[model samples]
Target chain A: MSVSANDNAAKVSVRGVLAKYSVLIAFAAIVIFFAIASPTFLTPANLFNVLVNNVVMLAIVALGLTIVISSGGIDLSVGVSVDMASMIFVMLLAVGYSGVVGVAGGLGAALIVGILNAIMITRLNISPFLATLGVLFIGQSTQQLATSGGQPIYLTSGYAADQFNAIARTALFGMPTPVIVLIVLVVAVHVLLHRSVFGRYVQAMGAQPGVAWYSGIRVPRELSMVHVLCALLAGVTGILLSATVKSYVPLSGNAFLLDAIGATFIGTTLSRERKPSVIGTLLGVLLLAIVKNGLLLVGWNFYWQQVGIGVLVFLVLAASFGLRRVAH
Target chain B: MSASVLHTEVAVSDEKQAAAKSAGRRFGALVVRLGAIAAFAAIMAYFVIFAPGFTSTFNLINVVEQSAILGVLAYGMTSVIIGGGSDVTEGGIDLSIAANMGLCAAVYATLLSMGYGDFLSVLAAIAVGMAVGALNALAVVGLGILPLLATLAVLNVAAGMELTLTQNTVVGASSPLLGVLVSGSFLGISALAWALIVFSAIMIVVVHRTSFGLRLYAVGGHPEAARAAGISVPFYVSFTYVLSGFCAAVASILTVSRLSASTPGSGELLLSVLAAALLGTVFSRRFVPTMGGTLLSVLFIGLLANGFQLLNVSSYWVNGVQGALILLVVAITSFARGSEGSR
Candidate 1:
């Protein structure tokens, strides 16, 4: 009987495997298609350049978003959180802080913001949606009031700091540091989510929180931890953004939140499962980035890559999950 | 749990015995929501005593003129929220609204400047805003995407288009006071104030005295129950957005009339409009959007903005205060108290 049950499980697993890989398969096809379309697209230089410039910070932000989403929560403030971090980082640099100190301070600020989001949701019991939205507003306001004049900060000297610049500039075998960082972080987070005890707790909480709690899980604490990690990742993105642009804008993160959320949700359709897959999210982000890249390469007249992302997210959602439950 | 069950039975018995009394109390609680307006009035009264030019016809007229567009947008938002959807879903923040209105103003002005007819240019602006709002609704309700995420995406799209087209400048108005009277009033009343009074009365009549208003409340209160009652969930959801778009269009026109030049990318004001709409919800004891509540909320915000300006407050302070006020309202209404619902 045990052998028979195992065999049944194996069959189910195999089906799951196929469903999960469909999105990756599409992604592989995209890379190959892009490679054929533009000779320069797959060259090591462009590959590394895009990875370093277009992708890494977003990947980190996406990772945080994934955790929140998996637990059935969301953070509309990630973009604003990143903006606040950039402002703080720039201000620190301007005030004569070392590169290490500035980056650390910026990330710490973001972490606090993240925790606040968690507190609002878990402690005060505000719906995650409304709470984060309020945070988003507060964050934008922070950027406006952080400086007396509400101007974007310039990290004049920090940009030239080799150590800081290395975030975007350093490469392993002609691959950028961001790509290396993304790979390492993804692999680590994947293991943390899938292979650890905490991982099991998270999934259980997401699938059924009350049941999980009755069965001996401290759900709120675990969820709060997830919230913190999201903010930390967004904060890191802020630092990376400054390194790439050599300056900071107040609202830079505003453009990334929805696109990352959309990409994350779209990625889930690939794995075709109840739970989000790290690998699937990576593929989704890649697909979205490439689509935007392709649009730019072909000189598409539509200026709202973000808007296209919003619409694409809708398509993905309709195909994967039905609209938020109706009365029935 | 057992004691509460007994209490529930007892409460039910008591409720049946005093239905009329209970309903009267409920109505009284609703009237209390009007206290916010009194609070605003008191604040304004203080300003009148302390701040210079606080009661001047010119400044009073300007305040009415300034709030007209925001008031209109709040009306659209209240409709959506009454149906239980959050306004922020359609990029419903004041900032987005202001930015969109600004862009429309710029688009109309530029076209008119380029020899396009006023009517044609105005139509184009309306079309653009409606299309954007519809796209937002379809993505969220039809496509199963999150509202906030979808709307912000449109926000970017709108922003990008505005920048590309306007090169970031004001458009539309060639006159110093083309539609200023739309905001001005007669017989010691600002026209804009009068417009709101009329709008609120009409909307109140539509929502409270019509089948549509009843359906809207039912939809918001319980979607499954509403569906069971045979309401078209998706249609109403989409229709609300279309209405919202229509409001944005009218508001944009009024905004252009006020600016005499459309400031490109002014839709960012949607954030404030959204806040006002949400605040209006709390003012109704029912926690549903009432036309009177929305109008009052607009007036409240308009008064606050006017008071700040009169008192020499900074714009940054204005934003912080605005954000704080919204957060407070969200907090107050977040859980809804233990009081039995009218349903």
Candidate 2:
């Protein structure tokens, strides 16, 4: 009986490890598959282009979402919040602020939106769904109607501050600034999520808030911090996006909503028991970037790309969890 | 004797005041809901009387026909919400409905134009639609992913499939069904309105009569409790989505008949339809997606849209206005829902 029990325990441990590793394996597979399908996919220039072009700010927003999802919550309003950031950033620059202030102002507006989300989610105990939905309406409409009577606003003057433009177009040590920014964010989040005691508390709070409460953690305040950080990251995402596109559009953030959620959920399934992890989320985002970059390079039909992403999200998540019984 | 009589009269008047207060609260809520409906009616009436051709048979038919798609989609969304899940996955629904219409139009138009039977095309579209709905159900139920996220992914896939199949847009079926579906009026009402009325009637009955309806409300109200009580939450959730899928297919048929082209961008209509469905919940008590409430929502939006054309203003204003309306409704409804939870 004792021998059998020991064998069972070892089997469970191995299974746990496999479930976690599958997420990374999946990312690796996609990267390799795409590289073979399209030689340019693996090219340094193309990879850099994909990073700098498609997913600078989104990576930041995804990082924030990872934090929120860790707390067992979700945010649909990020798209709108991110969109609002672009408008707020542009409007500030148009008002003739310095580049530093423009960036600050953009981040500041996102923080306010985030705080509102936290309040609605906390004080009112509203589900993140309803709360974010409320903001989605307000944010999208605000973006669309922010200018004079539903007209689109463009910044054709002064390059919206030269330094800001450089952030998007310029590279850090031969790497695109956005990619560099994404790396910095990933490192910062990794440290914050893993090394910080506060991070552990968030996990505890999500997995079992009651127990965390008994352990003397201030749940409300912790949740507020998490939300604020999320919004701030979203603000940064908006700034990056605006710089890259060289203008702000109301629909700028619309595409990210599903992708972010998909990435996060897919991220959760990556590391352990198909649960949330910092490393897993990063890998998931990378995997998606590869697929997107590869598809664009090869000129795959737009619809097929969407179908592939959908199938991948479902398949990887299922596979990640399915491997939970594996002994090795 | 006089003092006793005075005391009795005072007590009677106090009781009457208490009764009046209670009635006033009830009346206030009713008035608020009705006022929203009335405001929409007033707007429509203003257009009908003031704008040329606003009340003409052609324009009237246009309004009803436009509303049918929104109403059906909204109604479909309501069924899922009633089960306590937001269809938030991609575009948050079985968006293949529009695609279904497009697909049907393609299959039918090709066959008809090529001398194949029109009936086969229609059947093909519907069969594919039902299959699409079932696919959504299978994915959502089988996977423990959130309903909103699950359906959202499916929407993307379906949209992709539709695009690939049609290579973009397709010509509508050769024959228009407007004459048959909407040209024949009953009881002094337009046929489109009558068609909508019949659809709504069936929806209400389906929600109330069968065990399916009961299962839906139960699952939405409290999934764990319902599950513990031996209800199959997954089955109900999947079933409602599948049913909504069929509704979308039917709506697609209607739209193809009216427009003569299966538009690529019709996929986005789900968002507007959902907004209306959510608005209907506000008119309803406690997230109740009542047929009357949904129809009222349709009327409200229809009035606004039709009124816009009459005023000769750009239709873009309607999006901003609709967005505002949605925000306002949710803010108000949530405040109401929140108060109960706060207590």
Please write out the lDDT profile of model 1 over residues B1-343, one tens digit for every residue: 9999999999998878578656755655554454444655777789899878978887876776677888888887777676654433332222234445555666767777787776788888888778777876776567654555555556666666676677666564653234544444577777666665576677789888999888877776677888999998777767666677667777777776766766754756766776778678767766666777788778777877788888887666666666666655555455343233333
Question: Over the stretch B24-96, how does candidate 2's per-residue lDDT look in tens digits?
Answer: 5556556556655565567777887888788787677677767987887677777767765443332234434
Interface RMSD of each: 4.1, 3.6
Off by over 4 Å in 2: A1-19, A91-98, A115-126, A146-164, A192-228, A271-275, A321-328, B1-62, B84-116, B169-173, B176-191, B222-234, B290-292, B307-317
RMSD of each: 6.5, 6.7
- Quote each prediction's TM-score: 0.81, 0.81
The TM-score between candidate 2 and the true structure equals 0.81
Residue range A1-328, candidate 1, lDDT tens digits: 9999998777766655544454555567667877788777877777655666667877788888888877767787898768777777777777677778888888988988898888887776665666787787777767777766467666545344554576667778766676777888899779977788878888887777778889898888988898888898889888888877878877779667756876676666664444666776776777777766755655555555544544454444543434222211
* 10 residues in a row with least lDDT, candidate 2 chain B: B87-96
- The superposed Cα distance between candidate 2 and the true structure at residue B80, in angstroms, equals 2.4
In the range A184-259, model 2's lDDT, one tens digit per residue, is 8889988888789989988887777679889999877888888888888888888888876667777667677767
